[model samples]
Target: MREADRTTRQRLADALRAEPATPSELAAQFDLTPNAVLGHVEHISRSLDRSDERFLVAPPTCRDCGFDDFDDLLNLPSRCPGCKSEAVTEPTFTIE
Candidate 1:
């Protein structure tokens, strides 16, 4: 389908299926805010629950200590619990 013919959520799902990408990356590609991309991701994830495909998230990690375990996997934390670093990478999402 043409890009203009599809909904925002549908475009987002198609992007994820192509390759894993962070919210920031997707936001820029789709011309939306990171928060907006997150919202689309949440909806797409729910829709995929019944399908054989899976919505996978490579959780955010701290640039300082490389910590990837956070209480909330979707949102980016200001500080890393392991290293207390302010530099944290946003989680990458992909459909597998």
Candidate 2:
């Protein structure tokens, strides 16, 4: 891996270890796109899988109906199936 990429991933892992945050929040803190933050988080999750540590995810919820049965925890849902609302919350990630 490139040194800068490695450093960024390390920093991302550290930040996640410190606190749970949504992808948008992590992107803003790291000056990266949300997609980029997701990529780093995915890698971090894999790395954590090999150890005693766990990569935790708080799945997104629908603000309108409180629906949160998303099959994919990594991506944000566009709308709520329960109420068809577009106001869906983004998933939060953390390392524990």
Candidate 3:
């Protein structure tokens, strides 16, 4: 990535570190479109490549209990198969 892009990414990460912001919030903060912010996040996730960071982009989660899975929780159901809840909780990437 270019120097400017790197700087932007770092700033974004810093902002996220302070609080788990959704993509729309980040975009608005940086005067960028939501899609652009998402692109930057995707790049950052790939660059980190840390085993601990699992649901960086496509937030993997249970498809039944509406449970959220992040760096903290790794073992989550695939389809809420046990409960048959089917109330999957998808990650909120946008503030609104």
Candidate 4:
């Protein structure tokens, strides 16, 4: 992996160690796009040693629109329909 990618993974690992953050939270914390943050997390899991054992965690996702879950104000969709709006209020964990 490149040095910058490694650094980003390290930072992500540190943040995750500190707290269980949704992808969007990490994105906001680092001023990255949500997709970018998810990409980082995915890359981190792929490149890190013991990834299967330690980095086998995924961020929460909205049941409604199948949106990647977040802790910030904006990422949360008003509602979700994939799983229905009612399910939208809840978060499902994705590990893959």
Candidate 5:
């Protein structure tokens, strides 16, 4: 299908298939907010065919302390637990 005919979710899925992406990267590419990209990622994940494809998420981490153990993998954390740092890395997503 032509790019113009594809939905935002479709384009986002295509991008994921092409390579892994952070929410920020996806948001910038698609002209959407990071939160909006997360919403689309969630939708795409739910809609995937389990037999043919899988949606994978790399958990968010703390940039300062490299702490990857987050309580909620889906939600972007505001603060790091290991260190009181606000520099948390965004989770990465991909389709495989």
Candidate 6:
């Protein structure tokens, strides 16, 4: 099927199954904003809960101090709580 014909969530799921990717990567692949991709990913996570597959998250980290203690895995933080740095790495997701 043509990529344009597929739903955004379907495209996101397909990309993630093919390989683990950050939200930014998915956003680029789906031609969406990173925040938009996060919304789809959140729904994907819930959908996987009732299926045989599972959604895996590689939690975002603070590039400055290697902090990975963000309470919410679905939303990217603007700054690190540990070092107060804005250089935080986006979380990666995959299906397994």
lDDT of each: 0.91, 0.90, 0.57, 0.57, 0.91, 0.93
Question: Root-mean-square deviation of each candidate, in angstroms?
Answer: 1.1, 2.7, 7.8, 7.3, 1.4, 1.3
List clashing residue pairs in candidate 1.
none
Ranking by lDDT: 6, 1, 5, 2, 3, 4
- Tens-place lDDT per residue, model 1, 1-96, is 887999999999999999999999999998999988988899899999999999999999898898998988778577999978899989999999
**Model 5 / residue 34 / CA error / Å:** 0.3
Cα lDDT, model 5, residue 60: 92
Runs of candidate 4 with Cα error greater than 4 angstroms are 1-6, 49-53, 58-96
Candidate 3 residue-wise lDDT at 49: 70
- lDDT winner: 6
lDDT (Cα, 0-100) at 9 in candidate 4: 60
Q: Model 3: what TM-score?
A: 0.50
Residue-pair clashes, model 1: 0
| Count of backbone collisions in candidate 2 | 0
3 versus 6: better TM-score goes to: 6
* Count: clashes, candidate 6: 0
Residue-level lDDT tens digits of model 2 in 1-96 = 564666888989889899999999999998999989988888889988899999999999998888999888998678888899999999999888
Error of 4 at 8 (Å): 2.2
TM-score for every candidate vs. truth?
A: 0.92, 0.89, 0.50, 0.53, 0.90, 0.93
lDDT tens per residue, model 3, 1-96: 564666887787767656666666777899998778767776666656763543343454565454454452222233554466656553443110
lDDT of 6 at 52: 97
